[model samples]
Target: MENAENLLHKGVIEGEEGALNQFYYGYEANDPPEKQLSPPLKSKITGISLKRGQRVRLETPGGGGFGKSSERPLEKLNYDLEQGYVTETKDD
Candidate 1:
């Protein structure tokens, strides 16, 4: 991904004041065969659509958060392409 800007630090504040796009390699869950679903759906019946080089965003809640200004990688992400709801992952 290009143009990634880190927007926060560890319990302080740093960088630009806005959202940051984080990129990762993973597969999106695909829909089932012959099953009708939303065109932008990320998950199918029992599998996820295989993909790579996807991006997600992270931001502070209520327009404020604890962190310093620095470049910190995303801890974990399972973000939805459509809803923008990020789920934390247990992987590093």
Candidate 2:
């Protein structure tokens, strides 16, 4: 579905080495699913199969803001940019 977390085992399959059969990555923020009325839905995945000799790269989805993005402090937002947590256009 839309906005779903990405795959954890997204990497190149290289020489003879076994990859992880299971995926354990971070998740997006628990924002309300619709209309900002109900609580966030639970996010989970059953399992995944990996091939041998696969190079694995693990990454977690960054969570969204709890409230309006504008409500976030400029200092913190700038910090995020400085630390490469996120990027924004000059206009933003």
Best by lDDT: 2
Q: What is the C-alpha lDDT of each candidate?
A: 0.34, 0.42
- Candidate 1 deviant stretches above 4 angstroms: 7-16, 30-92
Kindly report which residue stretches of model 2 are placed more than 4 angstroms away from their true locations once superposed. 1-56, 89-92
Q: What is the alpha-carbon RMSD of candidate 1 to the true structure?
A: 13.8
> How do the residues 10-80 of candidate 2 rate in per-residue lDDT, one tens digit apiece?
22233122122233323224533332222222354444444453333343453333444455699998998
lDDT of 1 by residue, 12-90 (tens): 3553333343322232345333332223322222343534643222333223334542244443222232355433342
Q: Which ten residues in a row have the lowest lDDT in candidate 1?
A: 36-45
TM accuracy, model 1:
0.19
Indicate which candidate wins on TM-score.
Answer: 2
Local distance difference test, candidate 2: 0.42
